[model samples]
Target chain A: MLSVHRNHPWQAFDKLMRNSMNLGRDLDRMFLNPLTRQRDSFAGWPQFNLWTNDDEIIVTAEVPGLEADQIDVDINNNQLTVSATVEAPELAEGESYQRRERFSGSFERTLRLPFAVDQEKSEARYVDGVLEIRLSKPERDKPRKLSVKAG
Target chain B: MNNSTDLKTTNPPSHELQKQESPTPEGAEPTRETRLYRPHVDILDSADKVTLRVNLPGVNEERTDLTLEKNILTIRGHIDPPHYEGFELVYGEYGVGDFERSFQLTNEIDREGIQASVRNGILTVELPKVKQASKQKITVAAG
Candidate 1:
């Protein structure tokens, strides 16, 4: 029994090491795979996060360098869409540019809410380049106190 | 294909301004110039807090500075332009502008515990809620 107990830990360790090696090999294969490489060539799409509370759902999208007026927010049929364009800044004459990494031009993103939202009560705000939208959920979906009766 | 070539051939207004701003050679009159630099930023809400990621390439963490004044969070950094003294730039597309961006913080942010970090040219700022703002419970007793 003592031998079996000792061997159990060793077996677990061996399995963990094998899994680690497999993961490393898989990563290498992914990097070398042609389809994966081609997909990576495209510029990364913008990223966003959504949070839901008892009464509302809030969405925040990372879209730097765009003006609040340039951004458009629309909600229809339970779908929300945010779109904007970042125009290049005016440059000084004769100043040759060495590198330009900032992404300019148009971007659009659409999100679907798990629960239906009350469009009439929704609010949107943009400050310091971050666009935030708060969508109130329907009254029926909100939590309520239910009375209980003793049998 | 046609549009791509057209873009390649014509300089954007910003690029044209940059070229006109270059120092004139001896005996040539200096040209009047105006320059503008704007950094784009977007903020998205996460499960527990708001996550702000700023795209600031060529900006080192050491050179970047962040400050919150009057609810506005300002980020500033200087980037060194590419240097090649002798080689002529040919068919260039990228331009590096000085980085400056600011965001107004709301009451939801936990001012005391806001966190920031930079990795791979991206700056991520995590704005958490204060304890009071995140609280959801209240209790009452029958008289």
Candidate 2:
């Protein structure tokens, strides 16, 4: 399995292995803003959604402001990876950004499916800045119904 | 052997940008219909024009509408949610919704020359400035 976290000199400092910190955080949140849950769930660039069924698994990702050719998708067994190079918005001559809150840059993410996928039968489409990849489960891994015997 | 380092600065600023969730409007009732979001944006200023680069994914030119009323410029983008029939959503970090936001324009803007276009998933709106918007030197007459 590939890892998103890279090796750093101060990895221990970055990833704090706290034991009893959840109680303090929960207490702080209960007093501060407990009613409204913050939307800041994943601290990543783009967001993705995953759907699964008996036969197929669907993966949809938000790749805003990118062309179809600019995005690359690869699947190795059950692991799927998506990578893209997102460029900054084009400016004609003297225009400079006064305020910017959009995501852009080289992005790569890999997700694992429950079962190995049939790579040959997989299909992907980029529509309205959203990339959707559909992967079908191999015949052996697919669930088969066992008929009930009536004696 | 790197020893001395600034402890305050954990992650040094890089060129990579991160996505922020749309901010909920203050003092407004949350809509019960389709989810609404204020898309992230970038405001660019030039000598003669101010441009706005809006991040509106899942929206195309046909579904986007821009209008100027008085001094406020409104951008409304309609998006259709992905169909989840016969499928179970195992994981979701964000929800799909429409994008709607308004920006107040200054009087110096040349409203006539304002133009907008959409490419990929970004919307670019150019608001040109009027002649009087530039700096002018006033002459003083000694009486």
TM-score winner: 2
The DockQ value obtained for model 2 is 0.30
Model 1 misplaced regions, further than 4 Å: A1-44, A143-151, B4-143
Question: Model 2 over residues B1-143: C-alpha lDDT tens digits?
Answer: 32123211111233233333356678886564678877878787777889998888889999999999999999988888888689999988667888888999998799899999887778889899887635587889999
**Candidate 2 Cα misplacement greater than 4 A, ranges:** A1-43, A145-151, B1-32, B132-142
After aligning candidate 1 to the native by TM-score, how far in Å is the CA of B107 from where it should be?
Answer: 44
DockQ per candidate, 2 decimals: 0.02, 0.30
Candidate 1: CAPRI quality band: incorrect
Alpha carbon deviation, residue A27, candidate 2 (Å): 39
Give the CA lDDT, 0 to 100, for residue B65 in model 2: 97
The share of true interface contacts that also appear in candidate 2 amounts to 0.72
